[model samples]
Target: MHTIEIQKEPVELYKILKFEGMTSTGGEAKLLIGDGQVTVNGETETRRRRKMMNGDVIGFRGDQFHLQLSTHTETI
Candidate 1:
């Protein structure tokens, strides 16, 4: 797992998506979300601005992350 510390307590969907290199732009994340390629807490997530609260889990493809308080860990 790779750790990523953020300046804020909670992060938006687009931020983590880009931080994980899942997409280069918010547009890409929107498309991916709309296509049901993103998962939140083990279910398909379609909200582009889905607020990632601490301890939330997000998965895409084979990548997953633990959104900790003020930090996010990328699990490969």
Candidate 2:
């Protein structure tokens, strides 16, 4: 299981996949999600724009990721 920390809550599913290098591009991520190649909390997730929040478990291509909300906030 891999841990992914998000600075904010409710990130879009496809953005996560693309930003995390799961897919080369956002379009690919969307296609993959649409093809039922992704899961959330152990259930298949097909919504490319699915809102992923803290503690959400995502599965893709046999790999698992645990989403964690970053508690540290940066101040200037």
Candidate 3:
């Protein structure tokens, strides 16, 4: 399993897919999701803008990922 850290809560599904390189573009992510190629928590997720938070598991194309919130402090 892989972990993807996000700075915020409630990220859109397609954005994560695109950001994680699961899809080449946001449009591709949308299509993939719409085609039922993605799963959330072991169930098929067809909502492209589905809200995803920490602890959510996403599976696609034989790869699984766990969503986590970045806890590292950032220095300006």
Candidate 4:
């Protein structure tokens, strides 16, 4: 499991994929998403930018990610 911190309550599914080094392009993320290769909250995720948000758990590529909305104190 990996923890991804963001500045907002939600993050797009595509961003997660890219962040995890899954792919370099959003287009590729979409393709992987649509193929049922991505999972949101333990289910297949179809939305490219699914707005993960805080506390939203997403699973993809055999890994689970916990999304946390970051504060100014936190650095990227």
Candidate 5:
């Protein structure tokens, strides 16, 4: 399991995948999501643009990630 911290409340699923280096490119992230290779909270998620938030657990390629809001407290 790994942790990914996002500064914003809601992030697009594909962006998270790409940001976390789970996929080499944005296109690959989209393809992986569209192919049902991603899961959220243990359920398969196929929406490429699904909104992801804090506490959301994402699973892909046998790896799990727990999303956390960055504690920087700076207004974006």
Candidate 6:
């Protein structure tokens, strides 16, 4: 299982797919998601803009990923 650290909460499904290099482009990511080729927490997710947060698992192309929220600290 691969771990991905996200800087914030509520990341879009397509964005994650694209940003993570799962898809070449955002459009491709959206297409794959719209075609029901993606899963969230082992369940099929077709929402292109599905809001994902920490602890969400994404499955695609037989690859699984675990999302983790990065602890951002403010510097004085």
Name the best candidate (by TM-score): 2
What C-alpha lDDT, on a 0 to 100 scale, does residue 55 get in candidate 5?
99
Residue-level lDDT of model 3, residues 1-76, one tens digit each, is 9999998989999999998888899999999999999999999999999999999999999989999998988899
Q: Please write out the lDDT profile of model 1 over residues 1-76, one tens digit for every residue.
A: 3444555656888778886787988788888987899998899998888888777788888777777665445679
TM-score of every prediction relative to native = 0.76, 0.98, 0.94, 0.81, 0.93, 0.94
Model 3 alpha-carbon drift over 4 Å, by segment? none
CA-lDDT, candidates in order: 0.77, 0.97, 0.95, 0.79, 0.95, 0.96
In model 5, the runs with Cα more than 4 Å from the true position are none
lDDT of 4 by residue, 1-75 (tens): 888787765567897778768788888888989888888787887877777778877777678888887766744
* lDDT for predicted candidate 4 compared with the true structure: 0.79
Query: What would the TM-score be for candidate 4 when compared with the true structure?
Result: 0.81
Best by lDDT: 2
Candidate 2 RMSD to the real structure: 0.5
Clash-forming residue pairs, model 5: none
Residue-level lDDT of model 5, residues 8-66, one tens digit each, is 97999999999888889999999999999999999999999999999999999999999
* Tens-place lDDT digits, model 6, residues 2-58: 999999999999999999999999999999999999999999999999999999999
How high is the lDDT of residue 66 in model 5? 97
